[model samples]
Target chain A: MQQEQSIAFKTGMLSICLFILLGLLYLPPESVAQQESSVPPGTAIPDSIQLKPPIHIEVKDTPDDAGGSVTIRWEEQPVLENAVIQKYRILRASVENSVPGEFIFVGEATNRATVFSDGSTDDDSTYVYKVEAVYELKVDDTTVVTTTVQSSVSDEVSSSAQWFNFQRINVFVGVVLLSFFILYYIYQAQSGKKLFIRKIAGLEAVDEAVGRATEMGKKIFYIPGTQDMDNVQTIAGVTILGRVAEIAAQYDTWLEVPVSRSLVLVTAKEIVKEAYSKVGRPDAFREDQVHYLTDDQFGYAAGIDGMVVRERPATIFYMGAFYAESLILAETGNSIGAIQISGTAMPSQLPFFVAACDYTLIGEELFAASAYLSREPKLLGSLKGQDVGKALILISLLVGTILETFHIWQFSSLFKVIGE
Target chain B: MRREIPLLITAITGIVFVLQYFIPHAPFNKMNTWFSDWFSIVGAFAIWLGALNLLKISFQKIMDKKSDWFFALVIIISFFVITIIGFAEGQGFREPGTTFSWLYDYVYSPLSATMFAILAFFVASASYRAFRARNFEATLLLLSAFFVMLGRVPVGDIITGFLPQQYQLSQVASWIMTFPQTAGQRAIMIGIALGLVSTSLRIILGIERSHLGGGD
Candidate 1:
């Protein structure tokens, strides 16, 4: 059975129509005559033929790319007097044996967008694209009118890899400049030049913390973070672990490292074993010392929390990337009254480490820890080189901000690396 | 020979990758993909090293009756249970209705979420300790924390609704975050980037060997 339209809704709609007609009566005689000839409500008023179909469709291979992309552009057609354009849908198909039915929806754009990029196309394969304008002319809340007009299909174009990404020239220059400075400094250091590095409180306390743990006869917990070996922070953490393992070996303090990633486990195990061997205490290094926890973040945190509670390590070192679990691990170590030293380049997690740990290595300090502990001249040279690089960046940022504020220049783009 | 082999591999691959960033042509692009593929292959196999080690320790603890032997037993049991079901069920184990996925959803997921939830209490406790005013910097931190905390909740609007827009606590909090906090974060990020560059160069040149567990 068909549902009947409500009498109240019909009456309300009629009253609205009567109100509009009454308003039209106050208009000038010429405008009133025009209004009388208007189409009835909820009727399809065909748009004028003057609204041109989209034309001048063009497709070009995306520049500065290793193939597999095409950028499409076309002239967007104007809308009729009352017709609204919702969007432009892009369609693509193989140039050979291509039919209108074979075209696939490659992407969509806003009504105002004049271009679309399709990156899914294969290299060396010719393809064609068509742009369709989708517009909606709604007569009322209960009725909507939609229409589509397709542009002519674009000519077949093929994508090929470029030899060099010219857009990334800025990145190339920056890398070369930094490498020059580092290499020059390294050469200088090889000639017996001493490099000065500022003291880091966290690094300086390594010896004291290890001694305390040794004297207390309790183990030290070394968490190289919950991240895999691919992270640069984990690499930094593992290097520091090398230094710490040596200290623990020399002091004869038992060390335990719980890891989440299997690769980190293998890497950390090898580093600790080598550190123990270097200190002539290879017998003291146990294979079980560097244990593997589940790769699940919270599961790893739970394992550490339970171990920290039960065994109650004398000292804990969190020296890598951490996320939401940073505070949980730190606070638990705090509750056990263990001296905690934490370090991470994660700006968000730095505050939690600073709040809960006895000493915190913020940002670059974690990367500098191994060099600081080792005190090798060549390594110290790189620190000096890094300082110089930082000085240059600081100058750039200061000048860029002031110039941008006063509109004296748009200088920041000099440091921007496109296609990076 | 052992150290030299690793160092040689590191240097050759690192330089190639640095070049790959600027060169989009063949060979370099192909090498980058090849390198990443090799990394994935090695990573897949590296899991066995960790799993075997984990089992060795767990078994040792249980057989020798060391401390926390029950936990070791639990780890062993859970590991085999998951591994066997995963191997047996293959792709079907990932189905929502299957036993493996059901165990993951019911047992593992809830336990993980609970552990994450515990972080909320830990954060409160940490903030409490951090807020104690012992010095000038500490006092400043405490004051900032007070405004930031108050501005985050509905009561802040109720308390400061009478004030002008600029002087309101919420405005102050937003200003602090947009300017000072953002500035500090950026500075750290810049420093980290420079440090990473320096470290990467050191590694590629074999000047930093502590990662090999020794200071050259």
Candidate 2:
């Protein structure tokens, strides 16, 4: 009876396995038939059904926030071309880096033909790109598709440079005024000119925040944003870190900097070391205090959020190029009841910082904050120069607006001349 | 001497660059393009400086063996690996079956999308916390934000009862964006522009050397 039962069970399991195998085999044939009926790759179409090549393949010029991507654009062929053209296949070949004539297919578009972009190429790379028009063909029993590849590649393009557009007429006026002020200030500095800038309420609060942290024996948290050292805001943030470190050193308080960017970590370390040296507390400046987190945006945020919660700091300073993480960090700091002062030039993230933090630096104020904290003549002169430039712009806008309002067409030309 | 040389270069290049914009002749335009190209070359060099700085810190962390040093090691390893796979091999993962290309398209793209998706949850939370009717201004903001958000989604038209042909929700949203959002954004933008102009002037004139550090 046991042997009979085992035989029956074995037979049932074998049938079940066979059914699944047959089902898998049956499913692929339907998909294969469907694929076979559709147009296949490299199938040549009739010459009568020709499609126009891509038009005006223009590469975009923009700032490279992250060093890897470049955007390429092209105008769509006419609607007639679109009907015949099944899809647009963008083929990219590296002219400089790869073996002489190797081309790679980076992107494709079946529906949207007008614009296709390729980030497959690196910024450091010089690439030659050619787009082709793929045409669909209906044969007796099968369909064929063909691509009329462009004869020559598009002009070699490179990433845009880091040069600021300093050539605007408004900026010209600004430069002149700023130059005058800078020269005057240099003379003033030589002649012992007394330069006075009002004390920043935020900076003034720094000492108290440090003292409170020292009293409670809690750490002071400093985040120098996620941006690398190239960004000016990060530099400004690190400068403020120097000041905060000095106070921490003097008060015998622990100051910790968790930087998102690796370069920022190095710079913040040096700045902290210098501050500790100046305060004669070099021994207290631990290399471990300033450390690097991951370069990944959210990964760094998660690390910082963990640190903020686990080690509840008395004061939290967020300054630099922050994005979505600003709110995450700021809200977490607020919940901890830590005094949070945040500053960033990123316009989109500014509102979050303002809503969540005790004090927020709006655009230029973040730049000026470093100068205000440092009180050096050179830095102060720059702040004054910035003001003069603002004055020039204000005057230009006022004059331009009034002229355009009064329908003085000839004066408009003068304004345009100045504008250029 | 230190001050004079920088000042002279700043004034000459600054004035010429600005003046060239007004004069649109071949020579001036070419000069502008040339200036931009030179700037790119310098920018490329700056990338090396940044990358070096990045490696220095991460390597130091690995050597020190601090807590969470594994993250630092991962960063350094990934950095060099990607750089090699991308530039050295030149068959970036998008190039068919290369390891780097596969990692980039499947791993990097999805990871990027995931990071961006975090904004949805954050927006929901932030809106919930901030969109309260505490005051008149807050109420107005809440109403506009609600309308904008609602109109963007498919359910917006459903809620508004088959939105009339003339008073389309999309048009209203566009109008709100154009008039109020544009006006406010432009005003902030103008201030930012002026700020940038001033900052550049300061940099060129050597007034804003804080970016370089406080001293000569």
Please, what are the lDDT tens digits per residue for candidate 2 over residues A26-117?
Answer: 66332333344344555545565555667777765333222344566677666553236667667677777765555666778774656655
For candidate 2, what is the DockQ-based docking class? Answer: incorrect
Clashing pairs in 1: none
Model 1 deviation from the true structure expressed as Cα RMSD, one decimal place? 10.8
Measured against the true chain A, the candidates' chain A TM-scores are: 0.78, 0.58
**lDDT (Cα atoms) of all candidates against the true structure:** 0.86, 0.69
What is candidate 1's CA lDDT for residue A76?
Answer: 62
List candidate 2 segments past 4 Å from native. A1-170, A181-204, A260-266, A331-337, A376-378, A406-420, B1-94, B102-112, B133-137, B151-172, B200-216
DockQ of candidates 1 onward, in order? 0.57, 0.09
Task: Give a tens-digit lDDT track for model 1, residues A1-420.
Answer: 123457777788999999988888666542343344334554764545333457899999988888888999998676566567788888888876555446778899998999898989888678988887776655556556665667877898888889889898877777788888888887888789988789999999999999999999999999999888768889899999999999999999999999999989888988999999999999999988998987889888999999999999999999999999999899999999999999999999999999999999999898888788888778888888888888888888889989999886658777677755
Error of 1 at B68 (Å): 2.8
In order, the TM-score of chain B in each prediction is: 0.95, 0.80
Worst 10 residues of 1 chain A by lDDT: A29-38
